[model samples]
Target: MKDSLEVLPGIELSVIHFHSERFTMHHELFSDVLEVNYCHRGRIGWDMRDGSSVFLGAGDLEIHTMDCCADSTITLPLGGYEGITVLFDMEVLEDHVPELLKDAGLNGRALLKKLCPGQTPLSLPASPEISGIFSCLFEVPQKLLPSYYRIKMLELLLYLEQLKPSHVNRLTSYQSELTVLIREIHDFITADLSKRFTIEELSKKYLINTTTLKKIFKAVYEKPIAAYMKEYRIRQAMLLLSQTDDSMADIAGQVGYVNQGKFTQAFKEQTQMLPTEYRKRCRLRKMEKE
Candidate 1:
Protein backbone atom coordinates (compact mmCIF):
# COMPACT_ATOMS: atom_id res chain seq x y z
CA MET A 1 0.00 0.00 0.00
CA LYS A 2 1.31 3.42 -1.04
CA ASP A 3 -1.18 5.39 1.03
CA SER A 4 -0.32 8.96 1.98
CA LEU A 5 -2.10 11.36 4.26
CA GLU A 6 -1.23 15.06 4.12
CA VAL A 7 -2.63 17.60 6.49
CA LEU A 8 -2.54 21.22 5.42
CA PRO A 9 -3.52 24.02 7.82
CA GLY A 10 -7.11 22.92 8.08
CA ILE A 11 -7.75 20.41 5.35
CA GLU A 12 -6.65 16.78 5.34
CA LEU A 13 -6.06 15.04 2.07
CA SER A 14 -5.36 11.36 1.65
CA VAL A 15 -4.59 9.14 -1.27
CA ILE A 16 -5.28 5.57 -0.27
CA HIS A 17 -4.31 2.35 -2.01
CA PHE A 18 -4.96 -1.26 -1.17
CA HIS A 19 -3.63 -4.40 -2.83
CA SER A 20 -5.64 -7.21 -1.27
CA GLU A 21 -7.98 -9.32 -3.35
CA ARG A 22 -10.88 -8.38 -1.07
CA PHE A 23 -11.23 -6.70 2.29
CA THR A 24 -13.75 -4.97 4.57
CA MET A 25 -13.20 -2.20 7.07
CA HIS A 26 -15.36 -0.42 9.62
CA HIS A 27 -14.71 3.32 9.42
CA GLU A 28 -15.65 6.08 11.83
CA LEU A 29 -15.39 9.42 10.13
CA PHE A 30 -14.14 12.59 11.76
CA SER A 31 -16.96 14.54 13.33
CA ASP A 32 -15.76 18.04 12.58
CA VAL A 33 -14.96 17.77 8.91
CA LEU A 34 -16.75 17.03 5.70
CA GLU A 35 -15.37 14.06 3.79
CA VAL A 36 -15.25 13.66 0.05
CA ASN A 37 -14.20 10.34 -1.46
CA TYR A 38 -13.16 9.84 -5.06
CA CYS A 39 -12.80 6.30 -6.25
CA HIS A 40 -9.83 6.12 -8.56
CA ARG A 41 -9.89 2.38 -9.24
CA GLY A 42 -11.93 -0.73 -8.49
CA ARG A 43 -15.18 -0.45 -6.49
CA ILE A 44 -15.88 0.68 -2.93
CA GLY A 45 -19.04 -0.09 -0.94
CA TRP A 46 -20.28 1.95 1.98
CA ASP A 47 -22.68 0.17 4.31
CA MET A 48 -24.17 2.91 6.46
CA ARG A 49 -25.24 2.35 10.03
CA ASP A 50 -28.78 3.37 9.20
CA GLY A 51 -29.20 0.37 6.89
CA SER A 52 -28.67 2.32 3.74
CA SER A 53 -25.51 1.93 1.69
CA VAL A 54 -23.77 3.28 -1.38
CA PHE A 55 -21.23 1.87 -3.80
CA LEU A 56 -18.68 4.16 -5.50
CA GLY A 57 -17.03 2.69 -8.57
CA ALA A 58 -14.03 4.10 -10.37
CA GLY A 59 -14.46 7.79 -11.16
CA ASP A 60 -17.32 8.16 -8.68
CA LEU A 61 -17.46 10.67 -5.84
CA GLU A 62 -19.33 10.76 -2.52
CA ILE A 63 -19.73 13.51 0.03
CA HIS A 64 -21.00 12.83 3.53
CA THR A 65 -20.82 13.76 7.16
CA MET A 66 -18.75 11.98 9.79
CA ASP A 67 -20.17 9.83 12.55
CA CYS A 68 -18.73 9.00 15.95
CA CYS A 69 -19.80 5.41 15.81
CA ALA A 70 -18.48 3.11 13.17
CA ASP A 71 -21.44 4.05 11.05
CA SER A 72 -20.04 2.68 7.83
CA THR A 73 -18.20 -0.36 6.63
CA ILE A 74 -16.38 -0.22 3.31
CA THR A 75 -15.81 -3.22 1.09
CA LEU A 76 -13.15 -3.32 -1.58
CA PRO A 77 -13.19 -5.73 -4.51
CA LEU A 78 -10.47 -7.95 -5.90
CA GLY A 79 -7.33 -6.20 -7.19
CA GLY A 80 -8.10 -3.87 -4.32
CA TYR A 81 -9.11 -0.23 -4.50
CA GLU A 82 -7.56 3.20 -4.70
CA GLY A 83 -9.23 6.43 -3.69
CA ILE A 84 -8.65 10.06 -2.70
CA THR A 85 -10.39 11.53 0.30
CA VAL A 86 -10.57 15.21 1.17
CA LEU A 87 -11.56 16.26 4.65
CA PHE A 88 -12.57 19.91 4.82
CA ASP A 89 -12.88 21.57 8.18
CA MET A 90 -16.24 23.30 8.36
CA GLU A 91 -15.06 25.82 10.93
CA VAL A 92 -12.06 26.63 8.85
CA LEU A 93 -14.22 27.28 5.83
CA GLU A 94 -16.65 29.39 7.81
CA ASP A 95 -13.91 31.49 9.37
CA HIS A 96 -11.82 31.92 6.26
CA VAL A 97 -14.18 32.01 3.31
CA PRO A 98 -17.76 32.32 4.49
CA GLU A 99 -18.70 34.21 1.37
CA LEU A 100 -17.10 31.61 -0.85
CA LEU A 101 -18.91 28.86 1.01
CA LYS A 102 -22.22 30.67 0.64
CA ASP A 103 -21.47 31.33 -3.00
CA ALA A 104 -21.00 27.61 -3.45
CA GLY A 105 -24.50 27.12 -2.08
CA LEU A 106 -23.17 25.68 1.15
CA ASN A 107 -23.32 27.11 4.66
CA GLY A 108 -20.17 25.45 6.07
CA ARG A 109 -22.21 23.22 8.29
CA ALA A 110 -22.31 19.45 7.86
CA LEU A 111 -21.73 18.85 4.17
CA LEU A 112 -24.65 16.46 3.88
CA LYS A 113 -26.99 18.85 5.65
CA LYS A 114 -25.79 21.90 3.74
CA LEU A 115 -25.82 20.37 0.31
CA CYS A 116 -28.47 17.71 0.62
CA PRO A 117 -30.62 19.44 3.27
CA GLY A 118 -32.38 16.31 4.57
CA GLN A 119 -30.79 13.52 2.60
CA THR A 120 -28.29 10.74 2.86
CA PRO A 121 -24.77 10.80 1.40
CA LEU A 122 -24.36 12.48 -1.95
CA SER A 123 -23.01 10.10 -4.57
CA LEU A 124 -22.34 11.11 -8.13
CA PRO A 125 -20.52 9.64 -11.08
CA ALA A 126 -17.78 12.10 -11.97
CA SER A 127 -18.09 14.18 -15.11
CA PRO A 128 -15.27 14.10 -17.63
CA GLU A 129 -13.57 17.14 -16.15
CA ILE A 130 -13.67 15.79 -12.62
CA SER A 131 -12.63 12.36 -13.83
CA GLY A 132 -9.66 13.81 -15.64
CA ILE A 133 -8.50 15.56 -12.49
CA PHE A 134 -8.64 12.35 -10.48
CA SER A 135 -6.82 10.46 -13.21
CA CYS A 136 -3.96 12.93 -13.19
CA LEU A 137 -3.78 13.62 -9.47
CA PHE A 138 -1.13 11.05 -8.70
CA GLU A 139 0.97 11.89 -11.71
CA VAL A 140 2.39 15.02 -10.15
CA PRO A 141 5.63 15.17 -8.16
CA GLN A 142 5.33 14.26 -4.50
CA LYS A 143 6.51 17.72 -3.46
CA LEU A 144 3.70 19.31 -5.45
CA LEU A 145 0.93 17.09 -4.06
CA PRO A 146 -0.23 19.60 -1.46
CA SER A 147 -0.68 22.47 -3.93
CA TYR A 148 -2.26 20.18 -6.45
CA TYR A 149 -4.59 18.76 -3.83
CA ARG A 150 -5.67 22.24 -2.76
CA ILE A 151 -6.31 23.35 -6.32
CA LYS A 152 -8.27 20.21 -7.15
CA MET A 153 -10.26 20.44 -3.96
CA LEU A 154 -11.36 23.98 -4.81
CA GLU A 155 -12.07 22.94 -8.40
CA LEU A 156 -14.29 20.10 -7.22
CA LEU A 157 -16.28 22.41 -4.97
CA LEU A 158 -16.82 24.89 -7.78
CA TYR A 159 -17.78 22.16 -10.24
CA LEU A 160 -20.24 20.56 -7.86
CA GLU A 161 -21.90 23.85 -6.96
CA GLN A 162 -22.26 24.85 -10.59
CA LEU A 163 -24.20 21.73 -11.51
CA LYS A 164 -27.98 21.69 -11.53
CA PRO A 165 -29.33 20.69 -8.14
CA SER A 166 -31.01 17.62 -9.62
CA HIS A 167 -27.76 16.38 -11.13
CA VAL A 168 -26.24 16.24 -7.68
CA ASN A 169 -27.14 12.84 -6.30
CA ARG A 170 -28.57 12.71 -2.81
CA LEU A 171 -29.06 9.23 -1.36
CA THR A 172 -31.89 8.67 1.06
CA SER A 173 -31.48 7.68 4.67
CA TYR A 174 -33.21 4.70 6.28
CA GLN A 175 -34.06 3.44 9.72
CA SER A 176 -31.16 2.65 12.02
CA GLU A 177 -32.49 -0.78 13.01
CA LEU A 178 -32.20 -2.07 9.45
CA THR A 179 -28.73 -0.85 8.49
CA VAL A 180 -26.37 -3.60 9.64
CA LEU A 181 -28.67 -6.50 8.92
CA ILE A 182 -29.41 -5.36 5.39
CA ARG A 183 -25.69 -4.96 4.81
CA GLU A 184 -25.23 -8.53 6.03
CA ILE A 185 -27.86 -9.69 3.57
CA HIS A 186 -26.10 -7.81 0.81
CA ASP A 187 -22.83 -9.46 1.74
CA PHE A 188 -24.47 -12.87 1.70
CA ILE A 189 -25.95 -12.41 -1.75
CA THR A 190 -22.70 -11.08 -3.18
CA ALA A 191 -20.58 -13.63 -1.33
CA ASP A 192 -21.50 -16.32 -3.80
CA LEU A 193 -21.99 -15.26 -7.39
CA SER A 194 -23.09 -18.77 -8.34
CA LYS A 195 -25.95 -19.06 -5.86
CA ARG A 196 -29.53 -18.06 -6.65
CA PHE A 197 -31.94 -16.98 -3.96
CA THR A 198 -35.27 -15.19 -3.83
CA ILE A 199 -36.20 -12.14 -1.80
CA GLU A 200 -38.80 -14.15 0.14
CA GLU A 201 -36.20 -16.65 1.31
CA LEU A 202 -33.79 -13.89 2.19
CA SER A 203 -36.50 -12.03 4.05
CA LYS A 204 -37.36 -15.14 6.02
CA LYS A 205 -33.77 -15.98 6.83
CA TYR A 206 -33.03 -12.42 7.89
CA LEU A 207 -36.37 -11.95 9.62
CA ILE A 208 -36.77 -8.54 7.99
CA ASN A 209 -40.06 -7.33 6.59
CA THR A 210 -40.07 -8.22 2.93
CA THR A 211 -41.36 -4.86 1.81
CA THR A 212 -38.92 -2.95 3.97
CA LEU A 213 -36.12 -5.13 2.72
CA LYS A 214 -36.97 -4.29 -0.88
CA LYS A 215 -37.23 -0.60 -0.13
CA ILE A 216 -33.99 -0.32 1.87
CA PHE A 217 -32.06 -2.43 -0.58
CA LYS A 218 -32.82 0.11 -3.25
CA ALA A 219 -32.09 2.97 -0.87
CA VAL A 220 -28.68 1.58 0.01
CA TYR A 221 -27.52 0.28 -3.34
CA GLU A 222 -29.52 2.51 -5.65
CA LYS A 223 -31.05 -0.53 -7.34
CA PRO A 224 -33.40 -3.36 -6.49
CA ILE A 225 -31.74 -6.36 -4.92
CA ALA A 226 -32.44 -8.66 -7.86
CA ALA A 227 -31.23 -6.19 -10.43
CA TYR A 228 -28.04 -5.55 -8.45
CA MET A 229 -27.39 -9.27 -8.26
CA LYS A 230 -28.02 -9.72 -11.95
CA GLU A 231 -25.67 -6.90 -12.88
CA TYR A 232 -23.04 -8.19 -10.46
CA ARG A 233 -23.29 -11.71 -11.85
CA ILE A 234 -22.99 -10.47 -15.39
CA ARG A 235 -19.97 -8.34 -14.49
CA GLN A 236 -18.29 -11.38 -12.98
CA ALA A 237 -19.10 -13.41 -16.09
CA MET A 238 -17.56 -10.78 -18.30
CA LEU A 239 -14.42 -10.78 -16.18
CA LEU A 240 -14.17 -14.54 -16.52
CA LEU A 241 -14.70 -14.41 -20.25
CA SER A 242 -11.97 -11.89 -20.78
CA GLN A 243 -9.46 -13.23 -18.28
CA THR A 244 -9.77 -17.01 -18.50
CA ASP A 245 -10.12 -19.89 -20.96
CA ASP A 246 -12.98 -21.61 -19.14
CA SER A 247 -15.69 -23.27 -21.22
CA MET A 248 -18.91 -21.37 -21.78
CA ALA A 249 -20.92 -23.86 -19.67
CA ASP A 250 -18.44 -23.56 -16.82
CA ILE A 251 -18.37 -19.78 -17.00
CA ALA A 252 -22.16 -19.67 -17.07
CA GLY A 253 -22.37 -21.98 -14.09
CA GLN A 254 -19.82 -19.91 -12.22
CA VAL A 255 -22.01 -16.87 -12.65
CA GLY A 256 -25.16 -18.73 -11.42
CA TYR A 257 -26.67 -19.47 -14.79
CA VAL A 258 -27.24 -23.18 -15.29
CA ASN A 259 -28.77 -22.79 -18.72
CA GLN A 260 -26.21 -21.81 -21.34
CA GLY A 261 -28.84 -20.28 -23.61
CA LYS A 262 -30.16 -18.02 -20.89
CA PHE A 263 -26.64 -16.97 -20.02
CA THR A 264 -26.01 -16.17 -23.68
CA GLN A 265 -29.07 -13.98 -23.80
CA ALA A 266 -28.16 -12.14 -20.63
CA PHE A 267 -24.59 -11.68 -21.81
CA LYS A 268 -25.80 -10.27 -25.09
CA GLU A 269 -28.13 -7.91 -23.33
CA GLN A 270 -25.36 -6.62 -21.09
CA THR A 271 -22.38 -6.64 -23.44
CA GLN A 272 -23.91 -6.97 -26.88
CA MET A 273 -21.70 -10.02 -27.42
CA LEU A 274 -22.19 -13.73 -26.91
CA PRO A 275 -19.89 -15.31 -24.35
CA THR A 276 -17.97 -17.33 -26.91
CA GLU A 277 -17.48 -14.36 -29.19
CA TYR A 278 -16.31 -12.23 -26.26
CA ARG A 279 -13.83 -14.87 -25.29
CA LYS A 280 -12.57 -15.22 -28.85
CA ARG A 281 -12.07 -11.50 -29.13
CA CYS A 282 -10.16 -11.44 -25.86
CA ARG A 283 -7.92 -14.26 -27.06
CA LEU A 284 -7.31 -12.56 -30.38
CA ARG A 285 -6.25 -9.40 -28.62
CA LYS A 286 -3.92 -11.33 -26.34
CA MET A 287 -2.36 -13.10 -29.32
CA GLU A 288 -1.96 -9.85 -31.16
CA LYS A 289 -0.16 -8.35 -28.18
CA GLU A 290 2.27 -11.28 -28.32
Candidate 2:
Protein backbone atom coordinates (compact mmCIF):
# COMPACT_ATOMS: atom_id res chain seq x y z
CA MET A 1 0.00 0.00 0.00
CA LYS A 2 1.24 3.48 -0.81
CA ASP A 3 -0.28 6.62 0.67
CA SER A 4 0.86 9.94 -0.71
CA LEU A 5 0.21 13.50 0.32
CA GLU A 6 1.35 16.75 -1.19
CA VAL A 7 2.26 18.40 2.04
CA LEU A 8 3.35 21.53 0.18
CA PRO A 9 3.44 22.75 -3.39
CA GLY A 10 6.80 21.10 -4.06
CA ILE A 11 7.08 18.68 -1.18
CA GLU A 12 5.35 15.28 -1.12
CA LEU A 13 5.31 12.61 1.54
CA SER A 14 4.55 8.95 0.97
CA VAL A 15 4.15 5.96 3.17
CA ILE A 16 5.20 2.74 1.46
CA HIS A 17 4.35 -0.74 2.66
CA PHE A 18 5.41 -3.41 0.21
CA HIS A 19 5.17 -7.14 0.71
CA SER A 20 6.84 -8.52 -2.35
CA GLU A 21 10.13 -9.86 -3.62
CA ARG A 22 10.91 -7.08 -6.08
CA PHE A 23 9.62 -3.79 -7.40
CA THR A 24 10.69 -2.23 -10.66
CA MET A 25 10.71 1.58 -10.67
CA HIS A 26 10.59 3.86 -13.66
CA HIS A 27 11.63 7.49 -13.35
CA GLU A 28 9.97 8.93 -16.39
CA LEU A 29 8.24 11.68 -14.38
CA PHE A 30 11.19 12.38 -12.14
CA SER A 31 13.89 14.93 -12.83
CA ASP A 32 15.56 17.54 -10.69
CA VAL A 33 13.91 15.85 -7.75
CA LEU A 34 15.44 14.66 -4.50
CA GLU A 35 14.08 11.47 -2.96
CA VAL A 36 14.58 10.62 0.68
CA ASN A 37 13.67 7.18 1.96
CA TYR A 38 13.53 5.82 5.49
CA CYS A 39 13.29 2.11 6.12
CA HIS A 40 11.18 1.22 9.14
CA ARG A 41 11.32 -2.53 8.64
CA GLY A 42 12.65 -5.19 6.33
CA ARG A 43 15.52 -4.70 3.87
CA ILE A 44 15.63 -2.94 0.47
CA GLY A 45 18.42 -3.15 -2.09
CA TRP A 46 19.01 -0.99 -5.12
CA ASP A 47 21.19 -1.97 -8.08
CA MET A 48 23.28 1.05 -8.90
CA ARG A 49 24.32 2.39 -12.26
CA ASP A 50 27.95 1.39 -11.70
CA GLY A 51 27.43 -2.33 -11.14
CA SER A 52 27.32 -1.82 -7.39
CA SER A 53 24.44 -2.28 -4.94
CA VAL A 54 23.28 -0.42 -1.84
CA PHE A 55 20.98 -1.65 0.86
CA LEU A 56 18.73 -0.16 3.55
CA GLY A 57 17.66 -2.13 6.57
CA ALA A 58 15.37 -1.06 9.40
CA GLY A 59 16.18 2.36 10.92
CA ASP A 60 18.23 3.35 7.89
CA LEU A 61 17.83 6.41 5.66
CA GLU A 62 18.57 6.78 1.93
CA ILE A 63 18.83 10.11 0.14
CA HIS A 64 19.47 10.61 -3.53
CA THR A 65 18.20 12.00 -6.77
CA MET A 66 15.43 10.09 -8.50
CA ASP A 67 17.69 9.46 -11.46
CA CYS A 68 19.92 7.28 -9.35
CA CYS A 69 17.05 4.79 -9.13
CA ALA A 70 15.87 5.22 -12.71
CA ASP A 71 15.06 2.00 -14.50
CA SER A 72 16.36 0.04 -11.53
CA THR A 73 14.93 -2.93 -9.75
CA ILE A 74 14.39 -2.55 -6.01
CA THR A 75 14.83 -5.93 -4.39
CA LEU A 76 13.26 -6.69 -1.06
CA PRO A 77 15.52 -9.44 0.21
CA LEU A 78 13.24 -10.21 3.12
CA GLY A 79 10.14 -10.19 0.87
CA GLY A 80 8.65 -7.21 2.70
CA TYR A 81 9.32 -3.56 3.52
CA GLU A 82 7.67 -0.65 5.34
CA GLY A 83 9.02 2.82 4.84
CA ILE A 84 8.48 6.53 4.19
CA THR A 85 9.60 8.63 1.25
CA VAL A 86 9.83 12.39 0.91
CA LEU A 87 10.24 13.93 -2.52
CA PHE A 88 11.52 17.41 -3.07
CA ASP A 89 10.93 19.03 -6.43
CA MET A 90 13.96 21.23 -6.41
CA GLU A 91 12.81 23.76 -8.96
CA VAL A 92 9.43 24.29 -7.43
CA LEU A 93 10.66 24.14 -3.88
CA GLU A 94 13.39 26.65 -4.56
CA ASP A 95 10.94 29.09 -6.13
CA HIS A 96 8.28 28.81 -3.47
CA VAL A 97 9.76 27.79 -0.20
CA PRO A 98 7.13 27.34 2.49
CA GLU A 99 6.94 30.36 4.73
CA LEU A 100 7.65 28.33 7.84
CA LEU A 101 10.67 26.68 6.26
CA LYS A 102 11.76 30.01 4.79
CA ASP A 103 11.61 31.66 8.16
CA ALA A 104 13.69 28.84 9.57
CA GLY A 105 16.21 29.35 6.71
CA LEU A 106 15.78 25.91 5.15
CA ASN A 107 16.41 25.78 1.39
CA GLY A 108 15.83 22.82 -0.85
CA ARG A 109 18.87 23.30 -3.04
CA ALA A 110 21.06 23.84 -0.01
CA LEU A 111 19.70 20.66 1.57
CA LEU A 112 20.41 18.71 -1.60
CA LYS A 113 23.97 19.97 -1.67
CA LYS A 114 24.40 19.26 2.01
CA LEU A 115 22.99 15.75 2.02
CA CYS A 116 23.98 14.54 -1.42
CA PRO A 117 27.04 16.32 -2.73
CA GLY A 118 27.81 13.67 -5.34
CA GLN A 119 26.04 11.61 -7.97
CA THR A 120 25.96 8.54 -5.78
CA PRO A 121 23.14 8.01 -3.32
CA LEU A 122 23.79 8.63 0.37
CA SER A 123 22.56 5.99 2.82
CA LEU A 124 23.21 5.83 6.54
CA PRO A 125 21.68 4.63 9.73
CA ALA A 126 19.12 7.16 10.95
CA SER A 127 20.07 9.09 14.04
CA PRO A 128 17.89 8.65 17.09
CA GLU A 129 16.35 12.12 16.72
CA ILE A 130 15.53 11.44 13.07
CA SER A 131 14.05 8.06 13.90
CA GLY A 132 11.85 9.67 16.52
CA ILE A 133 10.45 12.11 13.97
CA PHE A 134 9.74 9.30 11.51
CA SER A 135 8.14 7.09 14.10
CA CYS A 136 5.58 9.80 14.75
CA LEU A 137 4.65 9.87 11.07
CA PHE A 138 3.24 6.35 11.37
CA GLU A 139 0.82 7.24 14.14
CA VAL A 140 -0.66 10.56 13.08
CA PRO A 141 -4.45 10.60 13.07
CA GLN A 142 -6.23 10.59 9.73
CA LYS A 143 -7.90 13.89 10.23
CA LEU A 144 -4.69 15.60 11.21
CA LEU A 145 -2.47 13.85 8.68
CA PRO A 146 -2.21 16.72 6.25
CA SER A 147 -1.18 19.27 8.84
CA TYR A 148 0.93 16.83 10.80
CA TYR A 149 2.89 15.74 7.76
CA ARG A 150 3.77 19.31 6.84
CA ILE A 151 4.99 20.05 10.32
CA LYS A 152 7.03 16.87 10.47
CA MET A 153 8.53 17.49 7.07
CA LEU A 154 9.80 20.88 8.15
CA GLU A 155 11.09 19.47 11.40
CA LEU A 156 12.99 16.75 9.59
CA LEU A 157 14.58 19.20 7.20
CA LEU A 158 15.59 21.61 9.91
CA TYR A 159 17.13 18.79 11.92
CA LEU A 160 19.05 17.57 8.92
CA GLU A 161 20.33 21.05 8.21
CA GLN A 162 22.33 20.97 11.40
CA LEU A 163 24.14 17.73 10.68
CA LYS A 164 27.84 17.77 9.83
CA PRO A 165 29.49 15.78 7.07
CA SER A 166 31.54 13.86 9.60
CA HIS A 167 28.39 12.61 11.31
CA VAL A 168 27.25 10.83 8.16
CA ASN A 169 28.39 7.26 7.90
CA ARG A 170 27.82 5.99 4.39
CA LEU A 171 26.56 2.45 4.19
CA THR A 172 28.72 -0.16 2.51
CA SER A 173 28.03 -0.87 -1.14
CA TYR A 174 28.75 -4.31 -2.57
CA GLN A 175 29.59 -5.24 -6.10
CA SER A 176 26.69 -6.66 -8.09
CA GLU A 177 28.67 -9.82 -8.77
CA LEU A 178 29.18 -10.57 -5.08
CA THR A 179 25.57 -9.75 -4.27
CA VAL A 180 24.37 -12.13 -6.97
CA LEU A 181 26.60 -14.88 -5.65
CA ILE A 182 25.30 -14.36 -2.12
CA ARG A 183 21.74 -14.51 -3.41
CA GLU A 184 22.50 -17.78 -5.15
CA ILE A 185 23.92 -19.15 -1.94
CA HIS A 186 20.76 -18.06 -0.12
CA ASP A 187 18.56 -19.86 -2.63
CA PHE A 188 20.69 -22.98 -2.49
CA ILE A 189 20.55 -23.16 1.27
CA THR A 190 16.85 -22.39 1.58
CA ALA A 191 15.85 -24.71 -1.27
CA ASP A 192 16.20 -27.83 0.80
CA LEU A 193 15.05 -27.11 4.33
CA SER A 194 15.74 -30.67 5.37
CA LYS A 195 19.45 -30.13 4.72
CA ARG A 196 21.85 -27.80 6.47
CA PHE A 197 25.08 -26.23 5.18
CA THR A 198 27.81 -24.71 7.27
CA ILE A 199 29.58 -21.49 6.35
CA GLU A 200 32.78 -23.34 5.46
CA GLU A 201 30.87 -25.85 3.35
CA LEU A 202 28.93 -23.17 1.49
CA SER A 203 32.11 -21.18 0.98
CA LYS A 204 33.83 -24.13 -0.70
CA LYS A 205 30.82 -25.07 -2.79
CA TYR A 206 30.20 -21.50 -3.98
CA LEU A 207 33.93 -20.82 -4.55
CA ILE A 208 33.88 -17.70 -2.34
CA ASN A 209 36.22 -17.03 0.55
CA THR A 210 34.46 -17.70 3.83
CA THR A 211 35.02 -14.15 5.15
CA THR A 212 33.63 -12.48 2.05
CA LEU A 213 30.79 -14.97 1.91
CA LYS A 214 29.74 -14.29 5.48
CA LYS A 215 30.17 -10.54 5.18
CA ILE A 216 28.22 -10.20 1.95
CA PHE A 217 25.51 -12.55 3.09
CA LYS A 218 24.98 -10.55 6.27
CA ALA A 219 25.06 -7.28 4.33
CA VAL A 220 22.41 -8.46 1.87
CA TYR A 221 20.15 -10.25 4.32
CA GLU A 222 20.95 -8.14 7.44
CA LYS A 223 21.81 -11.30 9.37
CA PRO A 224 24.38 -14.05 9.49
CA ILE A 225 23.42 -17.13 7.49
CA ALA A 226 22.55 -19.16 10.57
CA ALA A 227 20.32 -16.49 12.11
CA TYR A 228 18.60 -15.81 8.81
CA MET A 229 17.88 -19.49 8.28
CA LYS A 230 16.54 -19.89 11.75
CA GLU A 231 14.09 -17.06 11.15
CA TYR A 232 13.21 -18.41 7.72
CA ARG A 233 12.58 -21.82 9.17
CA ILE A 234 10.28 -20.42 11.80
CA ARG A 235 8.33 -18.42 9.22
CA GLN A 236 7.85 -21.55 7.10
CA ALA A 237 6.82 -23.46 10.17
CA MET A 238 4.22 -20.78 10.83
CA LEU A 239 2.69 -21.34 7.39
CA LEU A 240 2.62 -25.07 7.95
CA LEU A 241 1.02 -24.68 11.32
CA SER A 242 -1.72 -22.48 9.96
CA GLN A 243 -2.43 -24.29 6.68
CA THR A 244 -1.62 -27.97 7.17
CA ASP A 245 -2.54 -30.72 9.56
CA ASP A 246 0.89 -32.30 9.56
CA SER A 247 2.01 -33.95 12.80
CA MET A 248 4.51 -32.24 15.06
CA ALA A 249 7.39 -34.48 14.06
CA ASP A 250 6.59 -34.11 10.37
CA ILE A 251 6.35 -30.37 10.58
CA ALA A 252 9.54 -30.21 12.62
CA GLY A 253 11.49 -32.24 10.09
CA GLN A 254 10.03 -30.27 7.22
CA VAL A 255 11.55 -27.06 8.58
CA GLY A 256 14.95 -28.62 9.42
CA TYR A 257 14.34 -29.38 13.05
CA VAL A 258 15.54 -32.86 13.93
CA ASN A 259 12.96 -33.47 16.61
CA GLN A 260 9.82 -31.94 18.06
CA GLY A 261 11.66 -30.92 21.22
CA LYS A 262 14.20 -28.88 19.28
CA PHE A 263 11.50 -27.45 17.03
CA THR A 264 9.40 -26.44 20.01
CA GLN A 265 12.31 -24.63 21.60
CA ALA A 266 13.14 -22.74 18.41
CA PHE A 267 9.50 -21.94 17.75
CA LYS A 268 9.09 -20.57 21.22
CA GLU A 269 12.19 -18.48 20.82
CA GLN A 270 10.97 -17.01 17.54
CA THR A 271 7.27 -16.72 18.31
CA GLN A 272 7.09 -17.10 22.06
CA MET A 273 4.92 -20.18 21.64
CA LEU A 274 5.46 -23.91 21.21
CA PRO A 275 4.51 -25.49 17.88
CA THR A 276 1.37 -27.04 19.39
CA GLU A 277 0.30 -23.78 20.93
CA TYR A 278 0.98 -21.92 17.73
CA ARG A 279 -1.19 -24.35 15.75
CA LYS A 280 -3.98 -24.08 18.28
CA ARG A 281 -3.86 -20.31 18.14
CA CYS A 282 -4.07 -20.35 14.38
CA ARG A 283 -7.09 -22.60 14.53
CA LEU A 284 -8.74 -20.39 17.05
CA ARG A 285 -8.13 -17.28 14.94
CA LYS A 286 -9.48 -19.03 11.86
CA MET A 287 -12.62 -20.10 13.67
CA GLU A 288 -13.16 -16.60 14.92
CA LYS A 289 -12.87 -15.27 11.36
CA GLU A 290 -15.35 -17.83 10.19
CA-lDDT, candidates in order = 0.71, 0.85
- Candidate 2 lDDT, tens digit per residue, 172-279? 988888888888899899998988989999989989999999899989999989999999999999999999999999999999989999999999999987888889
* lDDT score for candidate 2 against the true structure: 0.85
lDDT of 1 by residue, 1-290 (tens): 64555444456778888765334455655555667888888766666544666667678888766652255556553347888987777777667653434566654564445554444567777578768667778689989877787777777666655656565554354554575577689889888878888999999999998999999776555578888788888889988988887888888899999888989999898888888888899889999999
Model 1, runs deviating above 4 Å: 1-8, 15-31, 38-72, 76-83, 89-170, 175-177, 190-195, 242-245, 288-290
Error of 2 at 162 (Å): 2.8
RMSD of each: 5.8, 1.9
